[model samples]
Target: MRLTVRHTTTYRYAPPRRAVVQSHRLTPSVFEGQQTIWWNISVPGAWTGATFRDGAGDRIETVSMLGPVEEVLVEVTGEVETQDLAGVLRGHRETVPPTAYLRTTRATHPDTGLRELSADALAGADGDPLDRAHRLSRAVAEAIAYVPGETHAHTSAAEALSLGKGVCQDHAHALIGAAIAADMPARYVTGYLFVGDEPMGEASHAWAEIHVPELGWVGFDPANRCCPDARYIRLGSGHDAQLAAPIRGLAQGVGEERLDVSVDVAEAAQSQQQ
Candidate 1:
């Protein structure tokens, strides 16, 4: 399948700042699952700076805006060709060792509840790594209800587990925490998902990738109760949600800031013809 994506993020500050710098991980990843046809990121009034790929194989680009900068806009427009790999990440080049993801982050820290959940899910299960991963994903889905506003960006996996409700971010965090508790390496992934008569959260999506000896890194969306497939667009990943954020920025001078984000992912032929 081929997909077209239009994502725009708008920012407003009550008081203008001296300067603003932002780092982006918005570009699609290069792997057997997806191929980038054309992609562009535009930040009006901001100068484009350095560009490089990190150890995790995610593209990093920087941009700066000179103040008094009261408003800023970051836009991403792209098209990609994707194939169903059954969520197995293949042909992807990355320097980071799989063991490196074993370390826990604040957002994915497993508490007693998570530990118990993981143990219970695998109690009578087989030893196959892939089967273990699937069990954990199912456990998380059954435990947490997908309610959009039940949590926020700073919500931790432990907190989400206790709440028993959250969005895709919470589900991913919970799955990561549980997977790590089971002595597996798991990380958070941010990307886009195309929904058709399904319960997909939004055009933008978050999921967990678990490393198995049989499969390198398999994408799991506990929130949707399935492995990522052709409808998904691969992006960057990190130990947790904050680190894997598509956009992270800082303003030299501060006033209260407001942000709005909108994303649309659709079939390339249909979107392009418009």
Candidate 2:
């Protein structure tokens, strides 16, 4: 399968600003099952500073803003060829030790509500790890009915779990919490998932990935009960959404600023030859 992704982010201020600085994590990398054919990024305001990578490495570039710049736009366009490795990925990868993923983070804290419990206890009716994880993900998806006004990026997993409502980000966090509690090393993955013929109003997507002793990192979309298959395009990984945010930065001046973001991920009509 081949995918073409177009991600654009723009910022507008009430009062015109002289300059600004921004960081982005929008580049898609070629991994075990995917290959990047061509990729590029464009910034309308001119590249003040930038970083690029094919997922495993990094490169940096810096440029200065013209003048009286009020808005900044960053666009990334790329084509990637992916192979179907469901069978291969489902099995364990002995080369990469499972213990490598046990390290903890703020979001994966063992004391966090969901992470406090063991997977065995959370399994309840289900005994298998995968089964337990799926059940928990589904429960979260159902419990947190996708309400737009219910949550935001800053919403915490414990808060969402307590409120019983939120979006994919919240669901991912809740799932991560549950996995950590179950004694699983789980991490947050920021990416895109296609809904086939179904129409979606949002651009980017979020899901959780757990490291099973031998199986390595397996993706679980609590929002959509299943592993990420061909529709999923991973951008990066972090302990939580904030750490793996696509774009983040700090401005010298302090006031109140509004942010507007848009994303588009679609399967290219033609698949690239591997």
Q: Which candidate achieves the best TM-score against the true structure? A: 1
Off by over 4 Å in 1: 197-200
User: Whose lDDT is greatest here?
Assistant: 1
- For model 2, give the RMSD to the true fold: 4.6
Task: Quantify all predictions' global Cα lDDT against the true fold.
Answer: 0.94, 0.64
Per-model TM-score, in order, reads: 0.98, 0.79
lDDT tens digits by residue: candidate 2, 31-147? 576667787878775765544442323223344464466676777777766665641234322343444345555544444445443343364564466656566667667666666
Off by over 4 Å in 2: 48-67, 84-121, 124-129, 270-274
Candidate 2 clashes: the total is 6
- For candidate 1, list the clashing residue pairs, or say none: none
